[model samples]
Target: MELRIGNKFRLGRKIGSGAFGEIYLGTDVQSNEDVAIKFESVKTVHPQLAYESRIYRVLQSGNGIPNMKWYGKFSLKTVLMLADQMINRLEFIHSKSFLHRDIKPDNFLMSKAGKSDFGLARKYRDSSSYRHIPYRENKSLTGTPAYASLNTHLGIEQSRRDDVESLGYILMYFLKGSLPWKGLKAGNKKQKYDKISEKKVSTSIETLCEGHPIEFATYIHYCRSLRFDDKPDYAYLKRLFRDLFIREGFQFDFVFDWTVLKLPAITMPKPSTLCKCTLLILSTF
Candidate 1:
């Protein structure tokens, strides 16, 4: 069956699905350009689609972040560029008085165009008001258990520091291919999450980064050191990645690991063939 969204894009085969909804490979009918259309039923339980869409709109113009193009997503080498882009994205989010509660490798979709996904994001408050949000213990767990910070698991209100801690785990996961808590067994989901949280808090940074880059451990340490109300030094965190990049003699070109993989033939329409009508409609969508 032929499916269309926002009256301008034709949805093709299903590419993936998550808690929010199903994502389909789609094409801008007029331009014949590829895009990914995510559809969530209006009654979807989480209702993160609208929030995620809004976040994408806010971040579309940010540096190093990806455009809306769904085709040509790429991975990075050494994850330095990835770190830099994510830090920029987070900085922009913070500047807007929002906190990205859910930060994981899955949430960070990389491509030629940058990072894209923000379903679990929420506005902390007005950027003009620098007041700290009080920690609440009654809130339920909100992010991926494996990568979530100890504070998140404890139900303390998440702040910028929690996001930074989550980023550290994600970066380490990218470099190490897996985290130490990947295979913990438990009687139930709650127990499982509790065990994961326990592991995250109990494990030392050195143990987490053992056999991996020392910088990875250091990054985790720095993030975990921040106070609940501390404003993170985003520049310093980014410099850690930059120093790693320099030490490894890697360049900031877009070439990445996925570029080296054997990808299927993707026929992208040339600029000359793209219809302005399609671009206009896509922008609205």
Candidate 2:
């Protein structure tokens, strides 16, 4: 039987699943538009969708963030453009006093430049006083290990720096097509996770960004230099890529490598000073 939601959406087949629950492709009855609806099992110990839904509500007006209904490519130009968008999104999230604990390629929807999956989203500041959260240690690792910061592996409390660092990893991953610790071997899940952490800690930025532009290393270095409570130099970091983009003579055309290959692609418009309401849920579950 076809399942219907809210008397407005008709659920289609299940498209994917994750730690929380299943995601179904559905259609809005009123508009006949497809929407990705996430469902969490009521019996689950850690219910996330409801919390994520709240975060979406707070973040709705932010640029590059996925709208409530919503929910990539491979190239330097692609990476640079993505870097700008991702940083912009992170800045907005931070400005709203929340941390997008999970920062990875899988969490981002390519065409929309939307960051989805806020199951691990956290508030880093006090709602009343606007005070930054105190630093702590020995917190369990959150987010994908491959793209996690070394501080995260060390069980330290994560902050904006960690998110920015994870973005650095993501950019390098895009350029290199895979991270160094992607397929580490171990006896079990815990062991494998430890190996990933070890690899991340041991891999120097120089070695990691070797053969890539110096700006990549600069980005990683800057991220690592930030203290837990330190505000990231978002403008400086963005300028690094924007300058590189200009130096490399890449156009702001949003023509990614995949687009050149004639693969399925979405043409993103040139960003304006004001945030645009360009929400679409194209993320995999």
Candidate 3:
């Protein structure tokens, strides 16, 4: 029951641990650069974690999610830092096609100082979490309870929106630093979630989402969007984020697609990639 940390592949410090395994701050022996090590001890059926990691690869291509390139044989973390760094990564994850089922403070880790990779995250980025359509369509719900959705709590079929609902709770926690709904009591499961549902997301968002309406509204609307058979439209959400910035007179570069930089303004003469992603959702099961 011991881990080999000082192998030839230089290890730095321990950062985090959980039910399945641990994560670490390691330095690639060949390149001598910082990397993350995620070890899976036993078969945990971790579709979400693996799925998230896969999705992170897509986001990493665009520079959206946190960058941890290495998934070695064994690992765990040696440190943690300000929670805000976690939020930044979370925000980037939400921007993609997939929903993050787990967004608690514990799952996030600050990259090495000045190693932020938003630039890589923003590149032609879209949701990579949608890759699970085949798996969850049959009802393989997974996530923590405190941050789970009403449907998820009841063991109903899992959907992308469920991830959004969880994100809403995460945003609330990000803003409030704690969940008020977690402390309350209820008669049954629905009643308990209804209590969480009734909580004002904006009140929490006003403080936590970096004072950005776009981010907060997406988080809140995302909760409402999770309550049905169909998923929310990413393009519409992208548009809404843009409009909110203009109407509210809020100034921030983080305003969803509003930061769209035209590569060439060339006429596609056909549907765009965003259009394809949207179509992919509407047409998918």
Using lDDT, rank the candidates from best to worst: 2, 1, 3
- Stretches of candidate 3 off by over 4 Å are 1-100, 108-141, 183-222, 226-229, 241-285
What local lDDT score does residue 248 receive in model 1, on the 0 to 100 scale? 59
Tell me the alpha-carbon RMSD of every candidate: 13.4, 13.3, 18.3
- Per-residue CA lDDT of model 2 for 139-224, tens digit only, reads 99998898889999999999999999999997777666456787577999899989999888888999998877899999999999
TM-score of each: 0.64, 0.67, 0.35
State model 1's lDDT: 0.63
Q: Which stretches of candidate 2 lie over 4 Å from their true place?
A: 1-73, 261-285
Q: lDDT of each prediction vs. the true structure?
A: 0.63, 0.71, 0.40
Considering summed lDDT, which 10 consecutive residues are worst modelled in model 1? 273-282
Give the clashing pairs for model 2. Answer: 70-281, 71-281
Predicted structure with the largest TM-score when compared to the true one: 2
The worst-scoring run of ten residues by lDDT in candidate 3 lies at: 276-285
Clashes of 2: 2
